[model samples]
Target: MSIKSTKIFNSKQGMLIEGNSLELLESDENLSDLKGKVNLIITSPPFPLNQKKKYGNEKGEEYKNWFTKLAPIFSELLADDGSLVIEIGNAWEPERPVQSLLHLECLLGMVKHPDANLRLIQEFICYNPSKLPSPAQWVTVNRLRTVDSYTHVWWIAKNDFPKADNSKVLRPYSKSMEQLLKRQSYNSGKRPSEHQISEGGFLKDNGGSIAHNFFEMEALDEKRDVRLPHSVLSFSNTNSNDYFLKTCREKGITPHPARMSGGLVNFFIQFLTDEGDLVLDPFSGSNTTGYCAEKLNRKWVSFEIKEDYIEQACIRFSDPILKSPLKKMKA
Candidate 1:
């Protein structure tokens, strides 16, 4: 199963490998230490789009079979309490505005696959308010559907209690929460649904409030203590000034066409893994997961099939915040 691949580059905290993830994960000698030790495998694999893209993807029923076969291999790389998080975009039926259930079917396939002992932990919505109206024909020309602004992020794990801490990814307290903390009082009682709220429960100010899944674009300059995060993650992928994109433009290199937002990657890496824990991204397009994991002090390994993308992704490691310089190594 040993396949020829390049180790394009490495930062002190991460390494970017160019190869087929399936073969590498199962048999790469360099990755022997990672077996059963990965804390998180966070990736946004190529979607099952109706049309093929340069990055490579399978369409329709074939995609589900392709993904299900890979689930067991992914599970084998996790520690008992390790997690797998996937961000997959929605797809539509060919030539129609109707939605496709392929994403859900793929998820179910992974979970039900005989060799994988994985379970669904939770589902989060990664909302991009600034996203342009998609499915151009249906949303714009045909005027059939509204803008599709979010992707489904599924959190699955080998164990029910995966390594996760909500406090690590908390958001800033809301205005009402700040007011409540200032007042040091509020209504607390049983509701018609019979769930009782204690006066002290809401009064105790524990930094910020728990986060929800529904997130909207908020002012980035606003600073506050971390609060609990919601299931809805709000981040836009339109930042041209990002280090990866900026460097790519300056170097006359075309960046990976599909890139995940760093904010989304940062949230899960911090929430799912601790400092020095290992994270892996089997489909590390532009190495966003590796960058986020490195910034968070976690060791990471990224697998990309394209060498050019790996080379371009190394720009992320050039930031001064990284502990060491990037090393370029031949395969």
Candidate 2:
């Protein structure tokens, strides 16, 4: 379709469109054809920070109004079985040690809106164990509160049963489960909870174990049995020498301050959409959603208001001058 965007950078499986996401998505001149075509819309928009940063954000109730307004637009763009995944960070009250409930309010506003009429499917915690402490005065100096290190990831959809396959994101079997499978035997009896444990249920090897939504620190801890996958995704965004950062630094372009992790994008994309399905990232900060979508063979489109961020994001698709670790991007 003839999308009237400011600039377009084409990749193998997707293109980055530079423009205001809200304006571009709401455009009747072109975006009319996009309705009911997108299988997934995963994005990490600017958080409602107490004070504005270089990227952009609105505070207090104003942020709620600004954000919830996109609900109808997103609802219209998604297919009947399409899913929407959003990652929002925690916000604190201005000049106070107290936390704000703006994040939860925004989430509720989206699903409860009559025009949007969306269903809340599931919630995830994107944990960064290596994340730097935030609200420094409260956490570091005053010691009044602990460090805030997790963001909320909400998954919603137009239909209750959106397109999803948990088997696709299953984790490897635990050591105990593996040993049980090898032994091919177990006590078949009732447990204290009045639940029956059948040998047949534990015998068959389903390749891997089913993962739960509550991710624990033990998953990352070596002392414990690491489950393959969970809702509390733990990863560090402290990579200073990665290809994207290196390129940006070399070119003197400041990288998007709040770039979402590639792993977070990959998980939701693989779980929610399949190959050739269309994905959209309205915020497109550093285009992590688009980059991950392209690698997974999904058709994608990214919208960003800032041209400079888009320029830096292009480095993700292009060849790097340095021998970086991301071989898939090169491939």
Question: Which segments of model 1 are wrong by more than 4 Å?
Answer: 1-3, 217-235
lDDT tens readout by residue for model 1, 247-323: 78899988777787777788788788889999999999878788778777899888888877777676767766665
lDDT of 2 by residue, 50-112 (tens): 888888888999999988998999999899999999989999999899999999899888899
**Residue 89, candidate 1: alpha-carbon lDDT:** 92
Each prediction's TM-score versus the true structure: 0.91, 0.91
Q: Candidate 1 — what's its lDDT?
A: 0.80
Model 2: lDDT of residue 191: 98
